[model samples]
Target: MDSLHHDLTVVEQIEVSPPHATIGCKSLPLTFSDIAWFAFPDPVHTLFFYDHPITQTIFIETIVPTLKQSLSITLQHFFPFVGKLAIFPTSTRIPEIRYVEGDSVAVTFAESDLDFNYITGNHPRECHKFYHLIPLLGSTTKVSDYITIPVFAVQVTLFPNHGIFIGMTNHHNLCDASTRFCFLKAWTSIAQSGGSDEPFLANGTLPIYDRLLKYPKIDESFVKNANVETFDEEYKLPRLSGPTNEVRATFILTRTKINGLKKLVSTQLPTLAYVSSFTVACAYIWSCATKVEKDELAAFIFVIDGRSRLDPPIPAAYLGNCVMPCFTLARTTILKSKEGFVTAAKLIGQNLHKMLSDKDGIVKDIGSFEE
Candidate 1:
């Protein structure tokens, strides 16, 4: 028999209520920054065990207020624009399973455990996952300028066996991996400390949004008074399948690996930095495929993140998907050459820098076309 079994006895008297509001923020004329934090579609949940059988009534009473207070403080600073984006705050809800007399305890355990399994499913393109918390999938909400993503709560439950589970899910597109972790850590600390009168949230002084908003004519006019070109056909990527599937070949290079690659390159060029490693790798990949891809005249493309090199820091993190891709061109024969990788990487990096540095016609070109 479980030692905590008797302690799990049900109490009929005490009562608790759910938190009235959750932590979130609001903003407008939204951009990728607003959507990025919202895209982590996984649920975020946590579990705890109380020393005594926590009656449903008492459990809700003690937990709800704490959740509300903590979240309220965390959101005001971390995600100042979340509420403005979403009609409502994603929340804290305690979901419980009822059991009948003499039902096997093991059966109860299985059902409650489903929550944990749900949190680990998909890692979104944005690269954030709450493996520990289940995401509320396929839900949507509307806020301000954009549609609201289906908001989810980290569900908490106390079992008759004196164990508890909390689950969470969030989409990665909405927040960067780092920002997601920061929010989680802050939320967890608050939960553990009960409720504090003063929440240590970050003070947001960045006014990139305010400045952009000031130029309303330039802002709204750019998107509206523009000439829109219509492509004759929809563009789509070629799908790769079958025996030769796309395999992720991730290599974590140590300082040694980097140094060795540089040494090899320097034997000819006299000086080469490890930053060119990706270019080298790309060359190797292209050489292997040139015969096949070139025969078909297919285009090969690589993506770059153009940020910070702008005249002013473009609020890349806060601005969400504030990114553009630059391309490097080559013939099949060029890619097959031994020096292709270095040459390509150098050109890629240089092009990236040039794109960010060139401000004369960047936005203006597009606006003029649209107008």
Candidate 2:
């Protein structure tokens, strides 16, 4: 662990904001879907490795400036990324992301001495080895009636002469995976076009900021579940630390393998309502994980994008979270049996079918968070 600390060096730390005075004070309130995640302390971390080799001089002179300039321009369109989350101490006052003029996102430039190829491989590696690449959000600070928390940060690490790694850390309450992907698409397009947002403006979709989904009871329930009154000046997000036994690896399931699992599920349960690649993949993984466990009940929880499932249906580009949870539970003994995979598939498929086919609409049970 001590050696891991010495393997990476911080080159520079800077803050990038939109062009001077382009964005004034702006705030976006959190909906029920977003408020459901208010109590979650883990921020989302992502790393992108590009196998482009270049010298340190070229990296600093060319790559660094290009990214910084493009990100600054991109922030003009996605102002919420540079904003801070404002959390009030009482549930009566909901939380929101507020951005004032001159607010910027923290960006770090770093260089690592570790093997780029080995770290990028599919094999399992110590999770701590990659922690240095992820940047931490700014500390939470109290301002009069509310606390402000930084929602997003970026870190770009150069594995000099091997590859370039881009790491991003974002608070979940700010946005979901789809919104983040859209932001990246816009950023990369602007960067490739030499810091000009003309190309992005021509083809990209701008985020919809209107608070579209409205369910007052559901929102109140989620706020109560989050226990907003407990938040104070001392609140801080959980940080990832090193020197642990955890290892991370990626597993790929080929199209043929996925089809085989689908076929197996279809053959056993001909009347099953849903048996797509996703359900089968989840069932297979869940079965494998619980096979060694003792005979006790276990639960599997996954989220479904509610954009299309809502009554009026939300725009694909609507910002913030619009997802609902789907849960499946079964005994470990059943999962470890010979028909474990099939049983798991049945459970997941039925649960999803029931949730999506609810007569009262998909958002009806959103108040379940209070349970």
Candidate 3:
């Protein structure tokens, strides 16, 4: 299985839009938070595997249509997923996601001969083996002074008699993890109801697009950092290439294990400002991953959701990035000591506490991030 070659056959490429004439042109401006990611070259890619034995004929006849129709319905409510990221040549004008009447998402249906269990297993596997299942976003197009970049794409791969794989690629400027999760929830609900969005409409929380966050100076700073003025027709999103030594594996911590780690941190550092499963997990991973010399500096950084940290507190369903990074730096000697895990946990916990309890608020020192 480790030596398995990539064997994928393209079934069809289809364009799916919201049900015809259901909505008009819609545009969403990039907030400072979104603008902060404008320079990030990597797009978010995700693969979902489901165990369901089915023949190729059944997959094409029923599964494909159901997913297609349900996705179309999902896009009607979550139009940003189908929109294009539009960036102008000047910092004075903010970038945006624009959805015209006929804008559609590229959805590819394919069949793969690769072993499903091997690819989905917990063991480390060649990263390129899964690359074929990930769909590529459409090429960028420039019109007038602004360039329009396709933001989202989907791929469905069928492994006959094994299972199905759903892969997605989306530009980070469009939204964050929470918003993406909400979109999936709506799509899954509609899918479960046979392509009807009525249930999702009645039960799910609609995305809030009211630009509730405003910090003009911060926006300007991020735009300047992104250097949008230099973007030209040759600009393109960075892409992933194959045939490398890179391997990816998944590591899961059960609830009991996480609890044990938490208890250990609490017992070791009784006065630590914060101690939780997430903090301990991060600390443990950091300590294990760092192999630097005793005196070298090591840093651990992660993002915190800022939806509730805002002055007015943006809605939980806000449709774009609302996260702030927390940085913890310490000498490798401390992290590699006998109490390495506990030391790492204390460093991360104290930094998290400081960020969450900042006297001036989370958005106060936005410019300091670049420093």
Candidate 4:
């Protein structure tokens, strides 16, 4: 189980079309960043909830209609999301994100009897409660096989007395963290402005569709790592499932604790350089998480933002994925030692420093992340 299951039923499935048809929408090529994730299982779902103390009649009558329109307008600018990914067997060209005039985003309207506060509390709650909120794209069983269904989906689950839930599921190949957030901000801005798609400049941060910033070709290592096995033609699992028997909790480290951690790092090693809050925090957590004995090896994997590191430097507003993961390897015993925290801090500092100073080496060592 990934989260605690709850009773969530769909009332309606709305096909949200782009307010304006996307020009030249037959096929859109995937960037190298996009191609890199082709072999992974269907992308995961994410959810957000809003606390609006409004009556059910008013919510169903007013907010639902506004959301649909705003979403349609948002999709006008992000038409690729309405389509599905295409992989041609004989063609040497990379996969494409294809769409037709009739393509639309699936937005489902749902209502939940589940306690809103129980799921949304800052204190620990059942992780299973999340299973029913977000819509899933599809599911797969074998390591190589996947079900590529819808590219994007949304759910509006009403909580009778508390608030509205805005849940979303996005295909990973299409957007990264930066792109996802921009799309969301666009939706909110339009909805707030009476659900209009006109004067797109008002959104300020439109996504750049330029493919020039991406690598000319897909990195071979990415695919090889994914297909160590073969693709299965069959499907097995349901779209989304919850993790079993696990308690979920959130921990907040106060400023006093953060300062104390920094002090500890300094005391552990005077030579530890560039010890920032992130370094100390990561180091402290890393030391605590690793339980292996002295001789085993442990790796700290960090994903670095690659926007400004490119040759000419890619624009911050440029869309698609532009990030790479770098790993720091050390002995588990050494990491768990009295100097473990300082060593971890130094290790993180070393990798971050390399990101700025030794860009080429890091780029060459880029390997796909597999779990």
TM-score, every prediction: 0.46, 0.94, 0.94, 0.83
Residues 1-371, candidate 3, lDDT per residue (tens digit)?
12123498888789999999876899999998898887677899999999999999999999999999999999989888999999898888889999999999999888899989899999999998988888888888988978999999999988999999999999999888889999999999999999999999899999998887777767777788899988777887888789789998989989998899999999889999789788999998988777555578888988889898765577899999999888899888888888889989998998888777765647454445545
In model 3, which regions exceed 4 Å deviation?
Answer: 1-6, 292-295, 360-371
Task: List, residue by residue over 271-319, the lDDT tens digit for candidate 2.
Answer: 9999999999999999999977888999999888888777677898998
Candidate 1 per-residue lDDT over residues 281-308, each given as its tens digit:
5544555567555533334465334335
Give the lowest summed-lDDT range of ten residues in model 3: 1-10
Candidate that beats the other on lDDT, 1 or 2, i.e. the better one: 2
1 versus 3: better lDDT goes to: 3
- Best-to-worst order by lDDT is 2, 3, 4, 1
Off by over 4 Å in 4: 1-6, 20-26, 138-148, 198-200, 217-238, 266-273, 291-296, 361-371
- Total colliding residue pairs, candidate 4: 14
Error of 4 at 41 (Å): 2.4
Model 4 residue 3 lDDT score: 24
lDDT of 3 at 312: 57
Q: Give the runs in model 1 whose Cα sits over 4 Å from its true position.
A: 1-25, 32-73, 79-148, 151-249, 264-307, 314-319, 356-371
